[model samples]
Target: MYNRLTLATLASLPKTITRPRYAREALRPGILHIGVGNFHRAHQAVYLNDLFNAGKSHDWALIGAGIRPADRAMRQALEAQDWLTTVVELEPGANTAQVIGSMMGFVPVGEDARAIVNALDDPNLRIVSLTVTEGGYCIDPATGSFNPEHSDIVYDASHLDAPRGVFGALVAALRRRREWGLAPFTVMSCDNIPHNGSVTRDAVAGLAALVDPELAAFVHGSVAFPNSMVDRITPITTDRERTMLTERFGIEDKRPVFCEPFRQWVIEDNFPTGRPALEDVGVTFTPHVAAFELMKLRILNGGHAAIAYPAGLLGIHFVHDAIANPLVRGFLDKLETEEIIPQVPPVPGVDLHDYYRLIASRFANPDVGDTIPRLAQDGSNRQPKFILPVTRDRLESGADVTGLALETALWCRYCAGTTDEGEPFRLDDPNAARLTPAALAAKDDPAVFLNLRDTFGDLADAPQFCSRFGIALKSLWREGTRATLQRYLNDGF
Candidate 1:
């Protein structure tokens, strides 16, 4: 008989799925992960579990923490099953599943984050890793800087005793770390931003500076925020996945994450308080992580944003189908080759073209079940980091930004509250309320959207980009998404 997934029921799991061989009771908490999402469970947690399974890094067990109301539900689900997650690796034909036990437990998710701050204050917690998505950084979409004016940032700044956000938790904990004469933990960002480590450092330091200038100095000088490039095509869990686990795997897992079998992690080696032997796993630690970060951001992440708007407007639901569409796929290949890759510097050992090939193949894997909405979500945060940088580089180098500008225009059109098929769908973005009005206004006048100095910067005033963006926006409104995509596909704007 199938049993619900738990440490107590590990031996009862079906033979196909791999369960942890090591004892969970022996694992000591060493890392504090902020977000317990699919990507974190699939990527970071998987790597640590691999290290633990090899009978190494037993002390580096992850203590999961969250700073949101949604995290409370996640905590409830996981706590019922001993914080174990069933990760199903979806390959083309052969499938593999595993029960990950790297997380010891979830910290309380509430307004008062003293529990979280106390956990971070612990000397044993040498590393504070985050997978809180690109938007979770609380970045101002227009300026690409941390938004100190954000409500959460404002609240956390004023209330030092009981901070609510992750940055606040870190700041409060660091205040104690400095006061108690303890070394600050390494803060590693596993998010998908360009120069993610440096971006994280800016956010943390900027927040700390507002809270206390002296504490800010100590945090700025003491903490090591490592930049990292993390990749895995992990999709959100759904009722479909839960059903699959029950029918095929004979395990009643409350939370099961399904993703592509392929995974990669490239990290900058900057851990100050000491780190686990993750290099023994597949993680590549390098002094120069910028090259890898830029390559992945501009190529893989940029390509995702490139296809998402068009695919969503065209009424395509899944990512594999979107890339399989000749128009969408062609647009991605051309945009990356002609516009994006040229702006990227070469990594020491990796071929750019081979990387593109790998990314395209991964997108084409139907089993991954990555959705267009998942990719298309949070375009405000995504476009600036992933697409706009490449566009800016091309513009400065005097290269044509027709394809890139068109991509941005497609984004504007996508934000206009309806798809090309005249069907309405919810645009899940933090800035959607303001964005929709601006986008709708942009349909008549492209300058309306471009005028947002925070988002477009001086790109709107640049004659070439301004003219091309106007043309593309007009064309998308007059002709349609498909025609515009096909026009770019044929190398014409």
Candidate 2:
């Protein structure tokens, strides 16, 4: 009853699984991670937990910090559990759960940024990892460059003493380290951006150049931002997850993270200062991460975008439900095998067919419970990264972009805030107010929506793309998503 009902007094639960010997032992801070979200827990923290379980890298542990007030809630939850998390991976035949104890402490962004900066200044802290979402970087999606003129960044440039954003905090910390004659920590970006490491380098160096040219040069020479491709379908936690762990698994975890069994982290081998032997725990360190990154971005993520909009429009809730429908699944399969895969560059040892099949299986995993609305959030930021890159490449190569163009049309239609059943759907993006109106007005004129320079950029003007997109939009508006998808599938688009 104690183990099943209450988490606060579970003394025996810690010993049931392979506990890290240092579960209760405090270690020196060696990594200062920003944005300690679920993916971080299931991926990086899981790696660190494995390393700690092996009784290696005890001197190097994690201290998490966050920039938002929402982080305070996470900090409080983690502190209550002594910075521990339970990660459960659901597979076909087996479900496994383990407690992770890699994080030592957390620092909150507050009235004074000194504590966070001081933590980063620690010479022992060799890695400053970030999972701050794509929007957090303030990069212009279309241009893939930092918007120095962004209000927050502009504020950061003017007032160095009081920094607001993550970039601002990072710049302030690096400047302090430089002034103290300390070597810069490796900047590892675990985000889903293309050339994420290079993007980080440019954004950081670009911001630094605005404030101090000399400091920018110093960063350029010393710092290392390693690009990485991280994947795992770890959805937002729910009360059902908590109940399952307590009732079925008999582990009362406060902030448990549930993910699919599949996990992959391909990282660029470019750490200047040093890094953990993450390779020992299934992280592939390679020079050709770009191939893997491109494959994953275009196939897995792109397929996700292809499915999300239609799922949202069809009144589907979870990813598995959408994949269960023959119409949706068939459309996804045809799109990937015929249209998307041809444009993808061949990866060294990987079969693209196998990869797509694997992605399909993962998407069909009912346990993931990945919501359509969650995936549909921030389409403005997501489309340019996940969808349009492939569209742009296909158009440039004179390859078939009919499917890609249709995917974009579906995205625009999804943004209109009305489902197939004529029920009101809430748009979940900051740019939704602008995008929804434009999308609705462009119900007949697809060009009106495509001209969204903020999202599509000049790719909107590509003649072939515009023609296909216009036709798809017209079909969807006239016949609804089901008929449009059925038509495309049957007519062989």
Candidate 3:
């Protein structure tokens, strides 16, 4: 039996639950990680925990920081346990539990980012890492570039001293560093954006330019934003997971992360100041993280987008269940093989088809318990990143976008916020309020949703794209999600 997990209970805990091998008290802070969520904890923290176990980079521990008020709950949960997190690695046959203590501290979330600003001033903090999701970057969907005119950017530019956003916090930190004559630390983005490094550099430099051109020049020159490709199948923590820990594993861990056995991190080896020796712990440091990024984003992420919306509309709850449906799985396979994969460039040492095969197997893993809701959330943000890029590639190449166009129309029907049975499932998204209205209007006028030119651009006006999309939307409403999917699978387009 195991009691609630805390540093004090480390001695009595079962040996099966892997504990940190190094001395926790001696571990010092080095990286300040923003957005300490499930993916970050499962993937990045696990790697650091491995390095700490290997007795390397003792000073390279993480100090978790949060900008959103919602993060306080995570802070309280972790701080209550002395910054320890229980990570359960879910494999095919068995699961393993491990306690990670690489994060020794946290910067409290607040309206003004002063706490994080002050934390960054410390010379020991050599890298500011973030996993703030793709939406957090504030890139305009019309163009794959940073949106400097975002309301947050405008607010931060004026209230630089009392800023609230991530870029605001970054600007404050760099300004402090420059005034104190400290060399600027590297900014590493672990998000799933194409050219995430360039996006980070653009957001920071763009905001800094508004504040001060000289400061912008300093930021543009001094900072090193390295692009990376990180992968792991981590699901939302459910009561089932908690019970599994308490009953099967004989441990009580609040907010424990459960993830797949596999993990991969491919990073561009560029940190001007310094970084963790993560390469020692199965992290691939390479120059062409872009290639890896494109491969993962298009093949894996696009695959998720392909199945996610239709799955949600069909009321499929779990990822495995969604992919298990013959129609859903067939749609994913046909779309990728016929339309998506051909546009992806050849990556070094990676067979694109083999990657797709790996993704297929990964999607079929039931132990991970990845939810369709998680994959389907934030369609306004996710579709642009995961699905639209492939559509654009096919469009540019003059390939038949019939499958891609149908996929977009399926997304349009999904946005209408109802299933074939007219059952109302809440559309969970940041833009749900606006998106729902546009989607509802599109029910009457098949092309109304396309007018949101910022997202669809001129493709909403293109005869081929719009016609296919309109047909798919009409069929989706008239027939149902399953019949529509079956039609597309049968090449009824």
Candidate 4:
């Protein structure tokens, strides 16, 4: 009983969650990870942990950093636990918990942003990785280019000495590294954006070009931005997750991460200076990461958007609950197999059917408890990346786009700021102010809504799409979400 009590006490503390058995002592910094969120914890950090556990590359432990104030809480939690995180993998019948110890330390964004830049400029730091969300890069969503004109970016561009944003911090740090004659760290992007490495390269290089052409040329020539395809459904942590960790696993990790059992990370093998031997731990270093990226983005993320708006309108709360609804599930499957898959170019050696099955299983993981609101948030940004790209592909190929058209209309109706019960709906997007107003105003004239050059751009003005989307939106407004979905399903569109 005494031994049991001691074990319980140790398990409850975050610091004692996972004690590395034979892992080597920390080595010099080789990687600087930005936006250390749950996905990074589950995906990249897991790979790094496996490498350390195998005694391969202990020198490359992670140094985590974040740009926003919310990241302060994460930094403090991890620092309290010595940068250890309890990763729980939820399987159908069993669950497993492993404490990941890849992160060595964290640097919070200070008022003047000196600390973050100093960390980045550290000669020991070799690879600078980012899981910063798509929006975090300050890319103009419609154009898929860096928005140098963005107020925050503009401010940072002018005030480079006192950098404010992540891009600014990166440029300042690179400048210091140049001054110190240290080789620039490879910038690897693990975000979900299509061609993420190139996107990040463009964002960084684009910003640098506006400030200093020579610096931009240096980055373009020396630094390697490797594209990657990452997949894992890591739900936001909640009180329930914390309690489960303590009660079920007897681990009290302050910043415990819960994720599905399935995980995938495919990276382009293009680190110029040096990188961790992550390939030793199931990280597929591929030349065809672009194909894999397109497959995941269109299939997984696209499926999420296809189901999210309709599920929200139907009052479904959790992802599993939404999937359990036969109507919603059937609609999603049809969209993938019939409409979406037809346009997706063949990804080498990937069985689309098997991929679809895997997606279904992942979405059905009740342990994840991913919320509809979380998926529904920022539809204005998500739809273009997840839904519209496929829609455009189908339309361009002259394929049937009725299902895709319905998906877009459902999204527009969802943004109208009210539910079927007439309760005020919440618009959870950065572009909410612009998108919501356009959506409301387009209630009578959809062309006006489509004209918001920011969200839809030219895609909104396509004649056939506009007509179909207009019809679907009008039907949804008159008949309600359920009836409109039922009509689309029964009518076999």
How many collisions per candidate? 2, 0, 0, 0
Residue 444 C-alpha lDDT in model 2: 67
Measured with C-alpha atoms, the lDDT of residue 73 in candidate 2 is 83
Instruction: Point out where model 3 deviates above 4 Å.
Output: none
TM-score on alpha carbons, each prediction = 0.98, 0.96, 0.98, 0.94
Winner by TM-score between candidate 4 and candidate 2: 2
Candidate 1 on 112-134: residue-level lDDT in tens? 78889888778999999998888
**Tens digits of per-residue lDDT for model 4, 63-119:** 998777767888987877667788988885687777777888899756656678888
How far is each candidate from the true structure, as Cα RMSD in Å?
1.2, 1.8, 1.1, 2.7
Residue 445 displacement in candidate 4 (angstroms): 2.5
1-493 per-residue lDDT for model 3 (tens digits): 6678889998888877789989998898999999999999999999999999999999999999988876788998888998898999888788898998889988987767878988999999999999998899979987878898999999999998888889999998999999999989899999998999899999999999999999999988888999989999889999999998899788787889999888999999999888889999999999989899998998999898889888988988899998899999999999999888998999999999999999998998888999988888888887788788787777777788888887888778888888777878878788888788888888789778988877887777777788878888888888888999999988667
Ordering by TM-score: 3, 1, 2, 4
Report residue 54 deviation for candidate 2 (angstroms). Answer: 1.6
